[model samples]
Target: MNRKSIAVDMDEVLADTFKKIVKTANDICNLSLSEVDVKGNRIWDFINKEQAKELRKAINTPGFFRDLEVIDSAVFAVKELSKHYDIYIATAAMEAPNSFHDKYEWLMEHFPFLDPRYFIFCGNKKVVHADYLIDDTVSQLDAFTGEGILFKANHNENTVTNHIQVDSWNEVLTLFSSLRVV
Candidate 1:
């Protein structure tokens, strides 16, 4: 099989970013929010603009990135995919400049095996080129010409149209294998 380039979104797909954000928000605001409640909802859904700003501030607290965790099967999946494709981390994160940098730093600290060149920070991923784009956003899926595999999670149910949806990283590996032959 020829080597193909794959682009992957960072936050939800690769790292448990949303989870940490919610936990930070709840801790800061003294609010009780379950993971189920935050799933499938946009950032604005649970918190207002002001609250969102506060959440971003909370993330800046020392050791936040050090404590961050990877999603289930993410490390193994990336390790396996690296053998066949040049994996790039493409993320849309300009909304909060500081947080974006923090997230990037966090990613680099955790996944040092990934080449720094492959880590791209963009406001719009639609302009990036790759044989495959693995993302959780439905709107982002529409922007790429290559096969867009929607990484299934809560709050992203609107992505059911015109895209391949995989509930697990193992399934993602299978999808790529199938695509390689086609």
Candidate 2:
């Protein structure tokens, strides 16, 4: 089989984005958002819209993304996977054009391994066709027709679904390797 084209989500998959957002929110609002509960393959719940708004504001704070930290296993996993497959960072950015540009630039600066061809900032990811998609949102997974892997998050519930669920980047790498063999 040919090398598969993989589209991976940026937030929880590549960076400690959700955690940072939560931390930022706490710092700004003095409110604690519950930890995400990721079960089986679904998110049991998520931060409410009000909290989400606060998190978004935090992300918009000056130099927020610039100082953001990449997830522990993301860089290594992407480097390893890139040797065998085309890895694309497909992210759902803020609706605002300026915010999107800032986020995209931040990603580019932080992850030099990510090429322009592999960086996509879009409002929706379901339409961006790829052989496999690794994402954190179940709704996005539901929109995709091809293989979708749910990168497990704190509030996920192990609900039966067509998508595969993996907790860590290493497991994601292993899953892809197995798929390549078959």
Predicted candidate 2 versus true structure: per-residue lDDT over 28-60, tens digit per residue = 667555444222321213456776676666666
Provide TM-scores for the models: 0.85, 0.80
Superposed on all Cα atoms, the candidates' RMSDs to the truth, in angstroms, are 2.5, 3.6
Of the candidates shown, which would achieve the greatest TM-score relative to the real structure? 1
The Cα local distance difference test for each model comes to 0.78, 0.72
Model 1 misplaced regions, further than 4 Å: 59-66, 157-159
lDDT digits (tens) for residues 1-182 of candidate 1: 66889999987798777777777888877779987877667655877778877877766555565556787898888888898889999887665445555667877876778897888878778887998899988888888878888998766855457788898889988887876644
Worst 10 residues of 2 by lDDT: 36-45
RMSD of 2: 3.6
